[model samples]
Target chain A: MSESAKRQSALGRMMLDEAFEARVRSEPARVAEELSLPLSFVLELAAISAERVRAFRASQRHKDAVRGGKPPTKLRW
Target chain B: MPRASVGIGLRDAYVEPLRDLRDRRALDVLEVMIDDAQFDRRRMDAWRSLGQRWPLVAHGVALGPGDAIGLDREYVRAVSADLAAVGARWYSDHLCFLRVAGERGPIDLGHFAPLALDDGDLAVLRDNAAALREQYAGTFLLENPADILGFAGQGDAHGRESGRRYTAALRACAAGALLDVTNLALQARNDGFSAGVFLDELDWDRVVEVHLAGGRRSGGLWIDSHDHPVDEEAWALLEHVARRADNLRAVIIERDDRLPTLEVLLDEVAHARRLLP
Candidate 1:
């Protein structure tokens, strides 16, 4: 994969997977090495405050609940 | 120039209420979700009826134009057909990637994902926007995604400058912008930048529509929850932009969850109409 794609993939995982995010939050350098991401990019991820991440996750969960655990199938008028 | 029209996003729960608003001359337009109109015949007919009554604008949630792999051609064709069916004045989708290539195939992220804002992503957006405009045979627009989680390479000054250049680039390719003022306010609040300065730097000539919504503060950041009423900060920013955006055409009050009475949203719409010069 290209460098940019790799970064996107890693970030996507972090956003979608709670366990992965936790792992990254606790051991960002190790995770970066395993994912072959640049140290600079990993540092950026590290800088994202835990509170912000929690807020984002909470919002996502709320959205899921609003959708009733199903992907958007129709317009909710 | 004509005054910008005010509208509300049509949702399932607001059908009768919207009809009432239309009869009362409180609504100027309706923004329909293209995805909802595509797969359901009954919904399409309802949207068509609403379109006949009020000017319709098409908006989509899942057209990830920023994907480097390119847009889904079949989906684009379907979207174009839906837009035609509804007689939409314009079409828009978020300028972010919702689907990404996965080992199995393509995976839907179920929400907007911020783009990298690099040359490659811009090229993707330009190409996709061009293709969409050609297929739809109408004006295409891209809404600014609410970047809650700061993406890499999007530092404050550099990111704002890159966004300006990218907006200009998209405009050059015939795609206008749908500026979500609420998202801008949230980003400014979270990132500690002056929203007014960012608006001043933007290529407003390319902005054809504006979205106003309400959000709540949570976990140290303001989330674009779209459940509450239009907040003061967003309304202030809307007022600021309304005075300056020369080519602005429409302003939509978007509410997706915790919908209040239709009268409440129409009141907000009236406030938006008052802001237009």
Candidate 2:
């Protein structure tokens, strides 16, 4: 995953975590605001943590590759 | 005496058919796949309306419960919110971890790469289960993910019977099992084990639900693609399990990528109904 893709992935994870934290902590309004999303968006994807982890990992790899003289690959998810 | 009375895997194409089923009750339930929030909310009202009358189970694909790290509470919370919206009876995910520790990063599809079992893997599974139980507060069904034959050159004192040990460890921690019949069939064909025997080895009592999908033999192995119709042999096993296990909750038919028509999906459901005792 490229650096930009990595950033997007982090943002996605951040968005998802926002949603998860919002639900788990019982703070729907906060989750909604952080996600910049509506009430329903906060609900469907809250507990799904793996996708973000994969994206995060991909991004970290992108950075390492750049430092070690390797080209970047785009992240699909 | 039978499989959750009746059930179906929630599919995009079948929404209209399910809405139609609301008329004559051709379906009893739909296991909603919470792959994305955007896709789910679009059908939220309709899904809610369907579930009010018919039962629904929230089946998640990205819990990463098997990851060897702290639980992803964020993802769990997201799915929970959606399930609550639809009033789902329970929720589920795969037994395999989707993320793995990479060189200065995590590797996707790392779980598929077979390796020697270490204490860390087992610990992750236990924590994953406890975390899932904590997040959902209901039955957490962990599914058997698709696997391929690879020695993966594990270190000594790690590999021998790694597959069985890893799966057994997860079963020990999981609240219930979501054994995919097609996965067993594919594994049996590709991995040189009898599918029937494999199913027999499972903790049948803990098997709350059954997943049925179609696969085709490909690239020296059978791939568990949910695109086509459920195969005959796998369907037979479903019937057998329905007869053997008294606590079977539901039988879900899953299809992804290439979706079949509504009539075809309903026919598969009808086939399952006929097989049920």
Candidate 3:
């Protein structure tokens, strides 16, 4: 991601975008049904995927801060 | 006898140092972080074997207030069983929510306030409290969390202001406060708020315990991940709070990430001990 583009990643501060959260909620079932993956595997994947996203945002924000950049503003609910 | 002045926040990482602290009389008390799997009879027996017979308060990371769904009954059951196993007096968890819907986070891994604070928030807690009451025979306490990005929706007062409101609400409920000074500083730095302001609003009368830790500022905002030395600001804050709260029970220094020597933590404990009332 571009550095400035990366700066928009708020520091683990994503409000449960009601819509986005709903999307994440349904992802495991969809992966299970479409990819023929085990439900447990899909659930684990979903969790790991979500954690990676949080970690990624966290890293991106950390980089921005280290380079003397202002962090992203808190997202309004 | 009255409680001691300063204490340390406990975690799995510090089990050895905790033993050392008890052995050397370094800490006044230690706040054991409540993990369901960590506290069993065998473990408690082993703890006793190691002479960890000092005063302790159990704190938790799984109190899922603010969830639309009710609390995770299994987790609550574990907490009760754990407290009974350890004979802990007061118990605490973050002032924010953990899981949501039913999926269990995005497993925020005990990150605080991903969800907004509302009446629903307190309701979920009250439900958990009722469940806790049914399972265990002790009172509950709460620790303020550091979420730089405050929940900016309905009734969204976080940081020290939120902590003040929390202090007010928990006071009304006749509960105890587990103030994490490091978190207060992390919140101040990240949220563009004032730690002093938060403390000024705090009802010291309700504070029963305090937690101190060093946070990593890697993520623009600070992480409450207990590592590094107790920063100067947090230590100063802890001393100020310790002096003001007459009912303050124990102060706990927390270390989670950067594994320092026991000597380093012992020194930090000494810093805390010097300020003890």
True contacts kept of each: 0.22, 0.00, 0.01
| Deviation (Å) of B164 in candidate 2 | 5.4
How are the candidates ranked when ordered by lDDT, highest leading? 1, 2, 3
User: Scoring each candidate complex against the real one, what DockQ results?
Assistant: 0.27, 0.02, 0.05
Please report the candidate that would top DockQ against the real structure.
Answer: 1
- B147-255, model 1: which lDDT tens digit per residue? 7776543446744663675475466456888989998888777776667666766787888999998888887888888888998888888888888888999999998
- Candidate 2 C-alpha lDDT tens digits along B1-277: 6446556777666677767654546767788776444444676776787777688887875566656644567767777777777788878877655554333465443223222234555666777777766667777787766554322222222222433553576565766777787876665565465655555456667778889988764444556656578888888888887887778888888876467776677788788889888
Write one digit per residue (lDDT tens) for candidate 3, span B95-128.
7654432122233323454433345445555665
- Model 2 chain B is weakest, by summed lDDT over 10 consecutive residues, at B151-160
RMSD of each: 3.7, 13.9, 10.7
In order of DockQ, best first, we have 1, 3, 2
Candidate with better lDDT, 1 vs 3: 1
Local distance difference test scores for all models: 0.76, 0.60, 0.58
Docking class of 1: acceptable
After the best TM-score superposition of candidate 3, give how far the Cα of residue A30 lies from its true spot, in angstroms.
21
Single out the weakest 10-residue window by summed lDDT for candidate 3 chain B.
Answer: B101-110
Greater TM-score among 1 and 2 belongs to 1
Candidate 1 residue spans exceeding 4 A from truth: A25-36, A65-77, B21-24, B152-159, B162-173
Q: Top model by TM-score, which number?
A: 1
Query: Which residues of candidate 3, in runs, are more than 4 Å off?
Result: A1-77, B1-5, B11-23, B36-42, B50-52, B102-110, B153-160
CAPRI-style class, candidate 3: incorrect
